[model samples]
Target: MIHNLFIRTICTALLLASAGCRQLDEEGLQTEVTIRLVMPDSRPVTCLEIRDETSGFYNINTYERTAFPTPDTNTATVRLRRGVYTFTVEAEATYDDGTTCLLRCADYNQITQAITWVREQESIVLLLKSVN
Candidate 1:
């Protein structure tokens, strides 16, 4: 009888410990997100702005150069808790003919859209349209 009772007690303790650990993991969960800004032709842009609508946290990055030679120049990776976000990008885009125009983020024919970030890792791509 004592041996059975000891086994039951150990099982119960293990169950409770596991449950507590799961709760802790959920509360501290964070996701690494990669945000990419591109033009309609899949060309990378040099300016980016991201805002977490739920927490009002925002980040902005701007480069002086007009051309982004590499994909890394227009991509940003950040660690964020689960939340909805708004991405805004504005930059000067130079064409092959030496023409320049202002570009801004556009999603589904809209100027800006909310993106939900909930997965362990996410890659978000935003399109930039000519603002002029």
Candidate 2:
């Protein structure tokens, strides 16, 4: 019967729509994050690392230090699963016999801004400082 065929077609359409929505929801769970670091003029950084509050730590510079672009000239970007993070950099000092130390971004900067990235968000910009 035509009525049975119409009912079946409607059910199929609804099922497909629900599937598509689930796919969209899964895709929306991730966010693209961009960290823009502001370096000091005195020291040049040799390594950079990012620590997710939820996840562990990630080394941004797996290749040669010179191979990776410095934040003084560029930015760092990564795809994260929506969470908070902290950035750290290691640099050699021009003074003090080229001493290398860990620089924490959150410690030096006074930025108390909280970002809640969502589905339509593009990228998050974080400004960090380098200290000895």
Candidate 3:
């Protein structure tokens, strides 16, 4: 009777462990991602958007143009499933001479680019170009 009880307990534990692992796998892994925006002329980001192409999940942020700090001030941290994403940004940069121009994300001659987030935590930087 003791031997049967021991076997049953071990089997029960194994089954529970397997079930938990399967559940975790089915849920997928979550990743924390930080995205930063940069403009060629060091402009303050007025608006930003990040989207997961596959999942259609997106986040947007808009900042007051008169904010003190300029470039590198636009940043966002979000939790997402490990996957690919795209970034969009709009900013108004004022030159020393009081000239202003709009900036948007551009990479390798493309207006938008795909970035992958696979690690538990990741940081990404995207370059913005003048749209005006």
- Report every candidate's CA lDDT: 0.57, 0.46, 0.55
Q: In candidate 3, where is summed lDDT lowest over 10 consecutive residues?
A: 60-69
Candidate 1, run of 10 with poorest lDDT: 60-69
How many backbone clashes are present in model 2?
A: 0
Candidates 1 and 2 compared: the better one by lDDT is 1
lDDT of 3 by residue, 1-132 (tens): 999999999999999999999889755676776667666755443443332221122322221111112234466666766665554455555655566676666442222445666788998776767775
Clashes of 3: 0
Residue-wise C-alpha lDDT for candidate 1, range 40-132, written one tens digit per residue: 665433443332221122322221111121235567676766656554455566665556676656442222545666788988776666765
Model 2, residue 124: C-alpha shift (Å): 4.8
Worst 10 residues of 2 by lDDT: 59-68
Top-lDDT structure, candidate number: 1
Name model 2 segments beyond 4 Å from true: 1-19, 51-74, 80-98, 107-112, 119-132
lDDT of 3: 0.55
Model 1 residue 54 lDDT score:
18
Q: List the residue pairs that clash in candidate 3.
A: none
